[model samples]
Target: MSFLLRLTSRLTGRQVGTDRFGNVYFESRRLQPIYNRPRRWAIYARGGREPTVVPPEWHAWLHHTVAEPLPEQKRYPWQQEHRPNLTGTPESYRPAGHDYVGGTRRVTGGDYEAWTPGA
Candidate 1:
């Protein structure tokens, strides 16, 4: 966080709520002149700067999609739990033929022949 944000948040921000990840959400005390709506923002949790760390309800509130944060509901058994993005991390998924797993890809028999120029 920068000094300007800290100062602005202190002066103009109101505590809205914190997400399960510990990210703090705030809304401006006064509505912004241009949008005519209070500005909303979030202070990410430590090591939780990745945007995907935010749950769907919190994300909606931050974007002003809803007047208030949605209440939590019981998840269905078939529903998958939320997870942060892991594209560049070791925990990310790798296909069977990927270089990191193994360079060789298994060959399957095929009837198609390679094309040649005019032959």
Candidate 2:
């Protein structure tokens, strides 16, 4: 699959850059026809939705802000590579102010607990 992707990219030949996440990007090899709309598409790890899914460093690369791929030998003190969110996974973050386990809301004095029919 990777081989196929590389071959297609070679044919298109606009590959200006790649990101830390290995997402390769390219501009149009030929001048786009006046009527042609810009392409807004990518193959993501879980699924592609919006640009926010891509973090700041990678966002810059995708937009051509930096000429080189991430992790250039000369490290910038502030520059950090992209890291995709894992909100839905067990490894997701639960900060000090956040809730890990939910408790039910009860206005009245009632034993509010999770529903289990047999229990």
Candidate 3:
């Protein structure tokens, strides 16, 4: 995959920018086809769900809101860092900083205990 990207990049003369999640972004050197929006220069990236994994700096660049890619510029001090959205995975969106969720709630809806009449 890297080889193909490197080859394409070489042919186009655009450098690859590696984001925080190992995703790569590139700008077109030839402006071959702009079918998506037709007016803006198309920016591309190799990514999966939740583009936040790309980090704030790269996110700006990926959307063409910024001109330069990461490693060249930096995140602001007040800007919070990136953490992949983990809503479904075992290791995702947990209360603690670390540790995976085991998916077992201690109390179930039907298992409530009734109070005794005279305790």
Highest-scoring model, lDDT: 1
| Stronger candidate by TM-score (1 vs 2) | 1
Going through the candidates in the order shown, the clash numbers are 0, 0, 0
Off by over 4 Å in 1: 2-4
User: Please, what are the lDDT tens digits per residue for candidate 3 over residues 10-57?
Assistant: 566555566545665666655546444212222234422455456766
- Deviation in Å, model 2, residue 81 alpha carbon: 5.3
- Count clashing residue pairs in model 3: 0
Candidate 1 at residue 2, lDDT?
67
Rank the models by lDDT, top first: 1, 3, 2
What global local distance difference test value does model 3 have?
0.55
List model 2 lDDT by residue over 1-119, tens digit each. Answer: 25675577667656665555555555556644773533322333334454556656556665656654455455578966455666777778766544564544435666777799988
Off by over 4 Å in 3: 19-23, 32-50, 70-80, 94-119
Off by over 4 Å in 2: 35-55, 60-81, 94-119
lDDT on C-alpha atoms for all candidate structures: 0.84, 0.54, 0.55
Writing each residue's lDDT as its tens digit, candidate 1 over 49-74 gives: 57888899888888988999998779
Q: lDDT of model 3 at residue 26? A: 61
